[model samples]
Target: MTKPENTGYDYDVVISGASLAGSAAATLLARRGVRVALLERHSAPETYKVLCTHSLQACAYPVLDELGLVADIEKSGAVHNQARWYTRWGWIEPRAAPTGPALPFGYNIRRSTLDPLIRSRAAETPGVDLLLGHQVTGLIEEGGRAVGVTASTPRGERRIRARLVVGADGKDSAVAKFAKVPVRESENTRFAYLAHFRNLPLPGGMSHTWFLEPDMAYAFVNDDGVTVVAVLPDKRRLPAFREDLEGSFLEFVRALPEAPPIDSAERTTKIIGTVNYPLLSREPTAPGVALIGDAALTGDPLWGVGCGWALETAKWLAEAVAPAAAGRGDLDRALELYARRHRRRLRGHQLLAADFAKARPFNPMEQLVFAAAARDAAMARHMYRFASRLIGPRRFLNPAALARAAAVNIRYHRIASRTARRPHKVA
Candidate 1:
């Protein structure tokens, strides 16, 4: 396509896919005085993604707080939860210790409430116009750069022109497809399933997980007296679950030590699940276009990193491009800045998550850290930091840190052996 002489744009930016990432980006960009057109294929305002467990990671709390949505989210009855992992050794639950601070907590509200709340906020923002039932069809290229999008709407089709086009869509992003973004794919060796239940209370309102090596189970607490029981077992066990999903899920959860009251709790939702989900990562930026959230990276769902990354990435994208979007600076430079930030922040975490998503036993390094964590509070905090994405993977994998964990684990085991050999006093 030949270069078209400069034409007027309806908005500064056109964002396709108005889910968490799309809507959040629209709000942030608009708040910075950049006009935005947010598009969503779903017409109903209340529609939410059912396939998700919808747990936000602690790393994202600051973003919510920054957006001034924390109070309203709490008012919506979202539960605050910290994670505890149950290994064969014991629960690697972190507490306040001399070596570090306490683990931060995150929110667990269903998507039904979260999606609409964020979308509504974007719609109400001064410079954002939320367009519903508008699915992206293609991009308008000028001088070999995307300058706008053509979307299929209820009436027919509309060409929305803008200086920049941002794709906040999902893993199967049409925006990315039209833009010809390069993709890096990884395989998922395990499948995931989840169901909601009532009358399922947890201690301290915290979430719990059992890491049974190749397979895993969880009882994640959510809002409105709901608990989301989920499992990510190896593909080898898929047949048993497929035969009887309810029975298999219940039996798996009940078999864990100190399990929730699944027998007494009433199942509220159907067995929502996904199999054959490949881990996906994409080049986040191109000429005149950018991608955020799942459109850029889709890690394994078991870790629940999607929601947190969505809000945080949107924050970064908006900050980097606000001046450009408002016509104050060069937009090309802004896209490059956002791309660098995205790769620097999330690339390592995404790779590590993909590696572990494969069905396999815990390697020696994993066992060493987990064993030490269960026996030592400081190690537990370190592991939690890594798992929470508060610290980078290198911090957890350094030779010095691994050696320290080994020392801690050996000391605890030696002391336990000595105590076991000692005769108990007669009572």
Candidate 2:
């Protein structure tokens, strides 16, 4: 970390990175009239996250609505739909809404549009100083407490002090590194590849995911008749992907039980990809500083929770620290509160996501529950509650739910067996 000459304080909160999480924090904080310094490495407003499919889960609707972004996002032509999980047993889709009165539909928009839209919103908010082309280089610590950040911008090295510093940077966070925070990463056993296409046929404009056990694929409809097709194959298939990225991806998608129209669609963007996108969880805060978004926790990208979690964490942090920034409470206590809330809300979800990131086959219980979900509407709602992350694992897999799932599977099997045993009509 580079040390820079002392510079006078600029804002109450200095946030590193101007991606989804950082922008969201800046937006909310600025709205509350908290002085904020939002720094981004990139200079251009149009710059967007290249690797993301930008699927915002239904649970994030409230946060978006609170931020006043829902109307703009809808105007941008975002696709509204429910997620349909294609399992070996059957397709598990809830016919009714997932028991939410507010914006019941999840959204899929291209990151190229979404990121800039969010950044623009944040920049327009009063009390936010959006500084671009600033790359974080070090933390400014005073008496064991982080007071500010050092950055190298196009002009020169600069130092900006603050009451509190926020690490909204992505997984490889410079702020986290400077704070000496410990991060535990779960090994990612799968490699993912995706591309954007036009005129891709997505029935009902619904997001579809095929759980091929050890290999997975999906087709997500987005704005303006564009669709994103992605495939996640186990690491063992690396050589094949390397040999022919496009061919391998198309082959995998085409081989799905219910294939998408990738072969016929016009490929609009170059196929983008990533390897070993593991689940990472880091300490959310240290004295005088705090972390949000991927800086705090990053689960597998396969579940499409990155963008949603980024927005959610930003909202959480802003809510926690707003009163403190307004001089009504202790900043340290606010950070502690944020930490506890982060753990309570995301710990279980992260653990499950990390386990699923291993690319292993589903266990017996998962099979039973998924099969039951396909056969029974009540069971499907319960499954969606968990899938949409409205409920925790304990509630999702409670004794009663498990027993109901088991009963449904048993009845389904019995009916299938009876039909098989009956003599076929001769014609």
Candidate 3:
């Protein structure tokens, strides 16, 4: 709905792209008494992301819990808790300390399940209007600031005026483009392919990852006991994968250490793949508009971070703008705070993810830390915290943690050297 050519507006916050990030922010802000208009281009309620592994990091638990989604997610049969990783050194399984609290677990529900569930939650909330099939056409600019958006809906072209506008659109964000948000781009040298299988129960029913040097593969136990297996190999290996799609996918899985039994399992879905997704980072805020999720930043999906980051970034946006959206504060200051919070929480992880997307072997620090993680349960937990996006580099790669990892590796080497020199028992 259009507003008068003045300070009046239709919504407190008008968010484009009502997927995970947009729905989340909409729900949270509405709960805080802000009227929100959540818009999505896709008209079908069942249309969910197909090319995702659906792994949410443990760090996202608190946010999901606050949304009252954990029980429903669990009821939908989403796998809970830890992921076991395979490195050349060995497996790194997250372990709890002897006398502390158990770590929070992540989920592996399909996007087909998660997207609709969360979207429904937002639509049911008191102050949110879920506008489906509305394609964003442009932004309404007022004095060098975005005042709202114009969209082509099923009805007709509608102009929505709001105090704040949010772009929760995916990696290729139309809202970010319309706002001319400053952006930096990096290229990823790996290509990815993934599919779902049934009756593929993994060891301990946990999600597994293979950090095979420059290549990475995953087997996640999803809802209804289905497993999603994926491989992100160097771009150089793309031809072989494309040449024999099913054969290559199965071969990769079968070659992993203590791999799951995919041979007897039923292929329940088509192999989906993507090549050359750039590592994108855009300035999150400009005047009256803000961006969340992939609109703000999107890195290599090899780490399975998009879902968790989407939810968590929504939390950041809601928290930053709640007061302003409630008509109690300045919207621009809220945007600035949200921008600072976004950078502080995720920029380091973005940098590191971009570095690894180069498809090179692990750096010396990565090698040492990963090797230590494989051997030491504590180190595994520590590294898992970082890998899970629960902690930032400033904490994970600090001198103290590095020193501990170094000490553990040193001990492992000395023991290995002694054992090698001692004997083979003349077997």
Best-to-worst ranking by TM-score: 3, 1, 2
Who wins the lDDT comparison?
Answer: 3
What do the candidate models score in CA lDDT, each in turn? 0.88, 0.86, 0.89
Estimate the lDDT of model 2: 0.86
Candidate 1: stretches off by over 4 Å = 1-7, 98-102, 423-427
**TM, every model:** 0.95, 0.95, 0.96
The number of clashing residue pairs in each candidate reads: 0, 0, 0
| Candidate 1 lDDT tens digits, 1-427 | 1122255887889999888899999999988988899999989988788888679888888888877799999999998767789998899988777665656867999999899998998888888888999999999999999989999999999998999999998999988999999889999999999999998887777889888988988888888888899889999999998999889888888888888888998899898898788999999998889999999999898888899899889999999999998788999999999999999999999888888888888888989988989988888888887877777788988898899899998898899899999999999
Please tell me which predicted candidate would have the highest TM-score against the true structure: 3
Clashing pairs in 2: none
lDDT of 2 by residue, 48-152 (tens): 988986788877888889888899999999988577889888888777745755326668988888899999988888888889999899989999999899999
How high a TM-score does candidate 1 get? 0.95
Candidate 3 segments whose C-alpha is farther than 4 A from its true place: 1-7, 423-427
Q: How well does candidate 1 match the true structure, expressed as C-alpha RMSD?
A: 3.1
